[model samples]
Target chain A: AQTVTQSQPEMSVQEAETVTLSCTYDTSESDYYLFWYKQPPSRQMILVIRQEAYKQQNATENRFSVNFQKAAKSFSLKISDSQLGDAAMYFCAYTNQAGTALIFGKGTTLSVSS
Target chain B: DVKVTQSSRYLVKRTGEKVFLECVQDMDHENMFWYRQDPGLGLRLIYFSYDVKMKEKGDIPEGYSVSREKKERFSLILESASTNQTSMYLCASRYAGTGTYEQYFGPGTRLTVT
Candidate 1:
């Protein structure tokens, strides 16, 4: 079974700074997908970024990017130039080639301090 | 833009009562998913539908049932609601084939079973 783990329960970052949320997963499948999602206080969850296992290059979307280490089974999210709006509960997810459903981590609450 | 909408943003039900959570997507996606979000647990997939009248059980399908009578609508039903079922329910949809792995999510419905 594939399982995702987010070790950090809470992370704090100063405004205009950078922060990284750690994530690790256990999956035997070689071809898979990894994703990071953000859920704000409004409770609307949105996809932040995604990376395919076949791609060695990390995925970057605006201020959000991911450090995907397939060999280590680690996928981390890095938020650069973080702003107050970036404060939210971030979740790391995994999906196999089937892509039916996503296996999610426990989540990391990111707090942006002004 | 893809839009996934839930029937309610908040719901209150009594234990042992029957609960129905409705989800609709405008993207005509072939895959729809139901997930529950808790504080420590990011999200757990309950059920998913590949197409109309096609359903599959996810990681945690116990005490939950689903119906997909139409391509764009997926419904999650709780046969007998319990207090432990009180959580934020999220609906998601995505394209069923390759080249697209991102899933669009709804605003979510916070169900409180008292």
Candidate 2:
């Protein structure tokens, strides 16, 4: 069974700074995808970024990027120039090659300090 | 832009009451999902349907059932509500196409079973 783990239960970042949320997953499949989703107080889940397992280059979307280490099974999210709006619960997710469904990790609540 | 909408943003139901959560996507997505989100648990998939009238059980399908009578609508039903089931319910949809790994989500419904 594939399982994702987010180690930090809570993370704090300053506005205009940077923060990284750690996530690791256990899976045997060689071809898969990793994703980071942000849920704000409005309770809307928004896709932040995604990384393909076969791609050596990490995926970047605006201020959000991922450090995808397929060998270590680590897929961490990095938020650069964090804004107050970045404060939200971030979740890491995994999907197999079939892309049927996502396996999410225990989320990390990110707090952006001004 | 893909738009996924839930029937309610907040719901209060009594114990043992039957609960129905409806989700509709305007993008005509082929895959729809129901997930339960709790603090520290991220999101756990309950059920998913790849097509109309086709459903599949996810990681945690107990005490939950689903219906997909149309391609864009997916409904999650709780046979009997319980306090433990009081959590945020999220609906998601994805295009069942190769290389389309992202899932669009709706504003969640926070169901409080008292």
Candidate 3:
């Protein structure tokens, strides 16, 4: 069984600043995928970024990036030039090569202050 | 663009009532999943299907059942809805592949049971 953990329950970032949300997971599978998802007030889940466990390089998507440390079992999400629209609940998820379901973290509430 | 649509955005039901949540995906995805989101519990997978008519139980499948008679449709059912089952339900789907693949999600259905 794989378990994702997001230690921070809530986080706040000033507008135009940068913020990092931490995530860690426990999985015995060598081949896997890591993902970050955002859910806004509309209750729609949106994919933020993704990282392949085999790739040593981190994944970046515009203002959203991931710091994936496979050895440490850590995958953190970083948001740069944060705006008010970035205020949402962020979740970290994991999926293995066995075609199994995704395991998700508790989530971190990001409050972007103006 | 891939679209996963839920039948309802909000629903209210009483305890012991049978509840059904429908989800349809237009991307011809091979995998469909149902999850429940709670305040601090993140998203817990209740059921998933890899192909039509094939269902698998996930982490929290105690009170939930699922049906996938068609490739594009997946349904989640609660035999006897309870107050504790009142939460946001999400539906997601992904293409079948060995490597990393992103899952597309639908706007969640918020179910309130009294």
Q: Which sequence of candidate numbers ranks them by DockQ, best first?
A: 1, 3, 2
- Give DockQ: model 3: 0.85
Compared with the true structure, what per-residue lDDT tens digits does model 3 show for residues A1-114?
Answer: 689999999999999999999999999999988999999987789999989898899999999999999989999999999999999999999988775788999999999999
Interface RMSD of 2: 1.0
Second chain alone, TM-score for each candidate = 0.98, 0.98, 0.97
Q: lDDT of model 1 at residue A39? A: 92
Find the 10 residues in a row with the least total lDDT in model 2 chain A: A41-50
Report chain A TM-scores, every model.
0.98, 0.97, 0.97
TM-score of each prediction = 0.98, 0.97, 0.97
Clashing pairs in 2: none
DockQ of each: 0.86, 0.84, 0.85
Residue A58 lDDT (model 3): 97
Residue pairs clashing in model 1 are none
Worst lDDT 10-window in candidate 2 chain B = B36-45
- The runs of at least 3 residues in candidate 2 whose Cα sits more than 4 Å from the true structure, single-residue gaps closed, are none
lDDT of each: 0.95, 0.93, 0.94
Evaluation by DockQ, superior candidate among 1 and 2: 1
The Cα error of candidate 2 at residue A103, in Å, is: 0.4
